[model samples]
Target: KYVPIENAKYTLTERFVDEEGNEISPSVVKGTDYEEGSEYDVTGDAKVIDGYYLKETSNTTGKFGKGDMTATFTYAKLGKIIPVDPEGNPIPDAPTPQYPNNPTDPGKTTPDQPVPEIPGYRPEVPSVTPTDPGKDTPVKYVPIENAKYTLTERFVDEEGNEISPSVVKGTDYEEGSEYDVTGDAKVIDGYYLKETSNTTGKFGKGDMTATFTYAKLGKIIPVDPEGNPIPDAPTPQYPNDPTDPGKTTPDQPVPEIPGYRPEVPSVTPTDPGKDTPVKYVPIENAKYTLTE
Candidate 1:
């Protein structure tokens, strides 16, 4: 008394397209009632979607007699370029750029990127064009306008040679700009200062010296004709090695004035403002020979 056995109606669609199909999410049908030939299957769920990147997928395993079946999942869009530093602040390693998803026109404009040299920085724009293929595209950078240096006040002489002539002081000074050069130091006759290089520095990027380093000034006084200083006279015999020109004060021996006759039999040591005099005079001719 039994006679029928019918049941066949399976459908399954999942589509999330956008390579050109343009639908980007929302489409998930399913209907079931299969038994015609008895064999069926369906599975699809690529979904993560933000900047998109799943490329392609269409035949998601099926056999419900082939009546309605879709699966589709194709997406592509993601192009970043960020490199800021004018206040936007993001130039740490600074070399980023990746783009390759413009199926027809994600807004269209991508093929230029090559602006990464940053050694003192200065790049408002030299390359980078990606107009929104999925966001993130900065590129700002700016900090290189310093090129006028020239602050050289050097007068060196501890051995670096060049004892004078090198002034220039300020020709314009840039790059952080704040030089002092210690008031441009220069009285240098017998030399003194002994140590300094870049004196007070702040300006950079080329041309800037500052070095003062002198050293060569000793004493050896015994002056009296009128120049004064002859009270004790021996305390001033220095120059052990101030750059040894035979060490200076070894011949300073004129200190005996009982009847007075010293016009300069021994004091000769120049340089420290030139002072070489050991004068005494008052012995006018007196010869009395008497042999016992």
Candidate 2:
């Protein structure tokens, strides 16, 4: 008497290999197997087969009744093929596989390798190099085409000594953008600020430079009773004076004039210079006695 065993069921899965030979799990079920023999035959199919070729067909188990079988069908992708120019020749380099011998098989090859760089010819697709086959792989060769410029500030004290901690060391600006420089120079005691150069207009293609200069305050001079500055005066002593060079001699009282009595007793001068003449109105208007 011969006993018939129940037919075992086998599952076939399809995987794709990309141009770089990276393995990619595709959502495809080739078929199911229900054969009664120890050794079973299996076949697979793909809805889309563009840029791909059947590389291998294998199974986890050769005997059907031993265990559940997984038949894996791997497809290798053709190299991305593109032309260097409109004429369609001289293709760019193909994606290099991370593992030479056992390249991970991704599902499909790149659409086309970027065209080799040629004078006056630009590729429609940007050139990108595939990283090692894995989740969240970083992309290579990002392009930067925007123009950039730099703004620099220089500060100096009245003695030409560089001030500590520059106001604005350097700043970056896009081309054609404006940079404000009105407040670049800082105020210092006993010194006046003078801006020599600044970036007020739209930024240009090249780097920008700003400059500032400071001047010391001028000395204050004192005037004497004669309205003339004391000659050969020394620098004024700070916060003190009995003989402070900035001090002036006390004014002498004006002598009494007989014909014209002065209306004011004395005049004081704040600044050193020639004395200002005093104007006096006649005390009494003369009628010449009208008789003579």
Candidate 3:
């Protein structure tokens, strides 16, 4: 609940902390009351500290009744007063929003144009490696190799109203199955363990929650602009190219190093918790110990 202060003004002052815990001072603004005890949901640009604005929900609360929120501002002994309005979203009137004019071209007053779609959603194969003639574009995107992820566990719904462990595997989603993700159930995996809910109970039998096992499935090779996979892509059978002209070779046999991992030619997880990953194991009478 909020109690508005008309005729009188409210303001709060505080120092700012940098991401590294350093304190910044000198430039500052104050916040006033929209009213006390009033619940409000929020949107708009994230609050900024040290030139960075906070985006997204830092927290959430209900809106006070049904009226739209407002803003009002007074200049500190340092500057000018800013008027009020819902600047694209609902924020209170007391804590006026201040935007520092773009300093790179502060003298020129025109605005920047907009490019509606991002590269991922653009038409054509967005350059695998940037070839931008303009200074604004990056030169190229470094391709990270041997990057791999494994499946782990699943968290699903409970049967009806009971709380028991009976969940399905995330492999279900890998093969393109319709599953739940909201409230009623969850689908957890190793590489990306999640415990979300699906209100409609789309995972499985009404109420069943359980721990899931994990395994390596496969890797993704970055495809080239000419419909071919990039030569250095981490796909099976494409390793050790001395010439560098890129070859589409056949799958190489697992090397004779008895217990070395011959399963995946691509990179595998190096950390499985507190222990360092063992790269190879020595075979002995069919049993082996991974090199410690």
lDDT tens readout by residue for model 1, 86-198: 79888765566665443443334346766666544677888876655556688888766765657767787878898888878777777788877675666665556656777
What is the descending TM-score order?
2, 1, 3
lDDT tens per residue, model 3, 146-180: 22222223432222332235434433222122443
lDDT per residue for candidate 2 within 1-292, as digits (tens), equals 9565566566544445444546655545545674544564455343234545455556624555534455555666444323343444443332333211122233333432343432223455554333321212212322234555567776666466766345544556766777678555665444445445663667654457676665543333333445444444332311211342232334423433333444455544343222324333334653333455
Which of 2 and 3 is the better model by TM-score?
2
Alpha-carbon TM-score of each model against the true structure:
0.25, 0.28, 0.16
Q: Please give the TM-score that candidate 1 achieves against the real structure.
A: 0.25
Highest lDDT against the true fold, candidate = 1
Best first by lDDT, ranked: 1, 2, 3
Q: How displaced is residue 56 in candidate 2, in Å?
A: 77
- The predicted structure with the larger TM-score, 1 or 2, is 2
lDDT of 2 at 162: 69
Candidate 1: global Cα-lDDT? 0.63
